[model samples]
Target: MAAKPQLPPTTVFLLKTRSSPTDAYEDLFKAPNDAGSRYAPIFVPVLEHRFVDDGLAQIDSLLTRRQITNGRLQSSTGGKYGGMIFTSQRAVEAFKKVVDGRHASTRENATSSWPSLQDVPIYSVGPATTRALRAIKLEPPLQVSGEHTGNGEDLAHYIQEDYAGWKRPPPTATDGTASTDAERPGPKTDAQAAPLLPLLFVVGEQRRDIIPRVLMGDASESGPPHIGVDEIVVYGTGVMPSFAEDFERKLNETLGSAVRWVVVFSPTGCDSMLKALGLLDPETGRAKDLANRPRTDFIATIGPTTRAYLNDTFGFNPDVCADEPSPEGVMRGINHFMAAWTASQ
Candidate 1:
């Protein structure tokens, strides 16, 4: 009888717990593709986050004072902040707590404490964050946007453009009547700048400053005017104490496969992930030689941020960096790597 070819190794995703039917990665690789490459996706929770009470209190104060709003009308009634920005699901969860806390008595009321803030623009980084924000019950519903941007830099630019127009007064028609100019808001003049409010960013203690830097950084001579951003640290993140052990247990169970992959999501779990893979040298506190390491082991990152972290911190370059931070993007990255590896072999 002819010898049969062995199957591709299992792949593990280092991420937090996600519910089924919604976890994109799980849904994507749930079955084998036409080429017959299948992945048994093992998700290991690497980080735990705790809400900061001080931050939540601040958000509550802003909400109660009616400070976070669309600065359409100037005066004491004008909201302190033009709108809100949410990038992480944890931050959204914290915001949800504050929103719900104030309206605990009126849980049945959909418009409960958020009536004054209904018109405020709530910018979300991606679909996950958007879903999280949408899940929160609020009156008039959350005016969420920027979900399609998929990352901070793009979303920041979107915010810069969208918010500028959002805060601008409707353009008056050349005629006496309000014209189609309402459909296309123009930039606010220098005279109108005084009433503009900065964006309120809800963030974690450990977060990328890309949004703030991109939005509020000094504008180039030809660039759009700088947009203001005010960030509140609403949560702190740390590696779970049991992460290393859990990763080791899961990895050992899958070692039977000749080829395996580890998809890292954040820098937070890089150390534990390397240790679990037996790639970290305890004495030297560095990764071992790739040549000496198992050829079957491969590493992938979800985005450039994590990829850059691995490269800078460990002198390690990932085999794949997903073009987009989506399940389809990850699949494309892995498949491309596999094709290149097979070709090289």
Candidate 2:
């Protein structure tokens, strides 16, 4: 019998916080934010969640104890804390600049149109993030409740439903001529000539309503010609949680396995989406202007907590490259991830 191949040792990288390196490292396996310290390190743990649950549980317990004392608890007496913070001073400075610039631009736009922040629909992932957005006076459109950590999937669903009312002209014939009733090709009897399928952007859990009708391939004499879902784009925001396991089962029932998962890391919101469309700098990360950035089809933020979850759960590395300091550098990192992900697919 052939021996089983041994897997390589997984290396976990830690991104420590400037103010609280110790707390950050200690809570490396669970959600980084659970550490109760702003200075907690951002970690990319390379281990499956099942194998590292104990470590994460220990960290969560430590965090709970520390929260009572404001992170002053000791590791020996029921508290386990120790780790490193991975970040560059330059990156931190650049991120601040980006945030400030974005805020200024948003303020300007809001001032010209609506004076109240409540009028705008801000999209956010968690409570902390919603609070942050609210602090900036941006109203969040959607908020996920419970342990069901929200990711890009929710955003995609929102966008699809929001834009469902929009209608566009159908594609012209191959001859580049509009067809009159008599000149039009006979009703499409061949399956290949079926109506164009709706393009589905499946960021996480596949939403049935959002998938294009053509992809479903449901043919019925009693109902309207079913439009099937055509393409699916998968945005990797966090390790796909429990819902991901049954995704294939659900997908098989509708679109089958012909679909592909296009993974893109859109951390900076619409700016990242525009870059993917090849409209913005693929390398420099410079935008022609804020106006040109693609409106976020959906925004999925992998905060410290989500990042830790992904690292601990899938052995996936969050810090795939050196910490990027500039906006352009971040875009480049995103592009690199997209390319690698596409190749793997």
Candidate 3:
């Protein structure tokens, strides 16, 4: 019998900090999707984050004073904000510190440390951030939403609808006196009604304004009522000093196996990432000899935001841009691209 042709080994380098226990990407690619394929995944930490004490203290005050609430339920004593927003895992980590502090201080109490804010809606951008928020140890727990949206712009639109409906009065049951459904009607749309309280957005120093803009921007003639927003920067991000060295070391280690894909999670580390890959030129700061580069070695972005950043800043177009910012979304895009490439070859 003749021997079958051997295929090149495939490896994927994820340029982001890995989540504890298990990262979604690591879990997704742990096993090959194909019987004939082999994939080795490596994580390269790109950014380091630190919590800001001032911002955390402000959140602690708000929770301590019973300031954040759903105005409809606690109208008399509710604070100025109705809910909270989270867009990144780092911000959630910072928020968790405040939560842990409160829990420690009130360990002797019979009730949850977070009493007034338990029922308030807590909006999250995607599954990763939602997971971080969900992991917080609260007594009654958090009411997290927008995990399905997968990005900021989509999550913002979802929040507008959900937050509006949340503020509306609950339905009333009919007494024996009334015979019609209108007599015991549900909450009605109140165009002229007072707007809901602002949402306290806890975010990193570097973040897009899409959420706040969409939720708090001017309401269109036909759109939902404009919700107010307040932002508190609870964390700051910076490229890890050893990113280039670490990334290059990983790439060299995987030299025996063809590094098939480099996934960029954020725009913060693109320059260093590309430089470490030996694809970026030293002077012009652009991709070098694209026509001669390995066709099988590709770059992928988490979503359109990073794609846009690479295109606009470096004039480099990534091979794949995941439609959604999730592990499944990235996998789908890569699979589709590989299928099309194979056909072309």
Candidate 4:
């Protein structure tokens, strides 16, 4: 009888479709030589991105020169501009459209008579978001966390320490610990040059409560956030209806019970998976109630926000999380996960 070829070492479930690298694993597992033993784990995407376009029109309204009057910074409501929070690259791209307006096709349109927000400290969350801010020509001292992956609570600490201008700020560490209450950030009045204006959070409709919880504190009401955020919905997350239909058929046809590794790149993707898998309630959309997920599955998340979601929502600790929220970081995390997994097996 003829000899049969052995299959690859493992199979992985990649919980991304749109932004996930096409050749991620191919590079990781491509055979060095034609005769060398080949080991490449198969990757199947479990989620897809559907960009919402509702709040896009609102950006044009916020970026008007009228928003900036008397050579002084003002809010969309004509109040003092506290500052802006750039948590995602999507928010950065959306803000650019607002400032760039219809003149985006023209290079001269990049610079408008409206004063630059260079004076206001821009607090960015992700490294990609930081790069996006720079791409829009916003200059530094753009305050960012030293670590690439972090939760909104981490962002809150950075704000309290760096933006709030405390006397002795906490160390820029990624361990997810807070400083003593006695060392809490001092308050900044609205009149000072470095005043702490009411922050205008340029966020999506499905945004998490972590930022509001940390910045604005607890609120007694709904509809309007209790936190100090002058919130604006620059975008919303729509769904790719095809992902559910395709994910199941493909998963069954290819992966079956062999599923070992799963990766979550965003909280939205995580929620979508939970809901789709019947582990979450679609009606309530709350994380308090939970259901059992696959015990054999180990999830690797891309950022701390997603990691926090996994912990807070279902009390499930991720197997591994990316140190850098990039394609390379994803590969590194996967390799580390496989190494440990192999050792255990």
lDDT per residue (tens digit) for residues 1-345 in model 3: 999987754688889988976798998877667534455678999999988889999999988888887663223434678899998988888888888888888888865546455678999988999998888877578989989988788889999889877743332223312123323457543322445778899989898899888887888869777888889989899999999899888877777764478989999889988787777789999877787445647899999889999988887899899988898888888878877777776
What is the C-alpha lDDT profile of model 1 across 1-345, one tens digit per residue? 988986664675646666433776787777766545788788888889899999999998898888886653343345678899999888998998887777885568764455366678999987878988888877668889988987999999898788877744443333433334334458644334343578899999988899989888887658766778899999999999998888888777877776778888789889778877777778876778787444877888889989988888777778899998877788888888888888887
Per-residue C-alpha lDDT of model 4 across residues 4-35, encoded as one tens digit per residue: 87655444556654322234435544534332
- Among all candidates shown, the one with the greatest lDDT: 3
lDDT of 2 at 260: 21
Best by TM-score: 3
lDDT of each: 0.78, 0.30, 0.80, 0.55
Clashing pairs in 3: none
Ranking by TM-score: 3, 1, 4, 2
Candidate 1: worst-modelled 10 consecutive residues by lDDT: 170-179
The list of candidate 3 runs beyond 4 A from truth reads 1-9, 34-36, 72-74, 113-115, 167-192, 343-345
TM-score of each: 0.84, 0.21, 0.87, 0.58
Estimate the lDDT of model 4. Answer: 0.55
Ranked by lDDT, the better of candidates 3 and 4 is: 3
Of the two candidates 2 and 4, the one with more favorable TM-score, higher being better, is 4
User: Model 1 — TM-score against the truth?
Assistant: 0.84
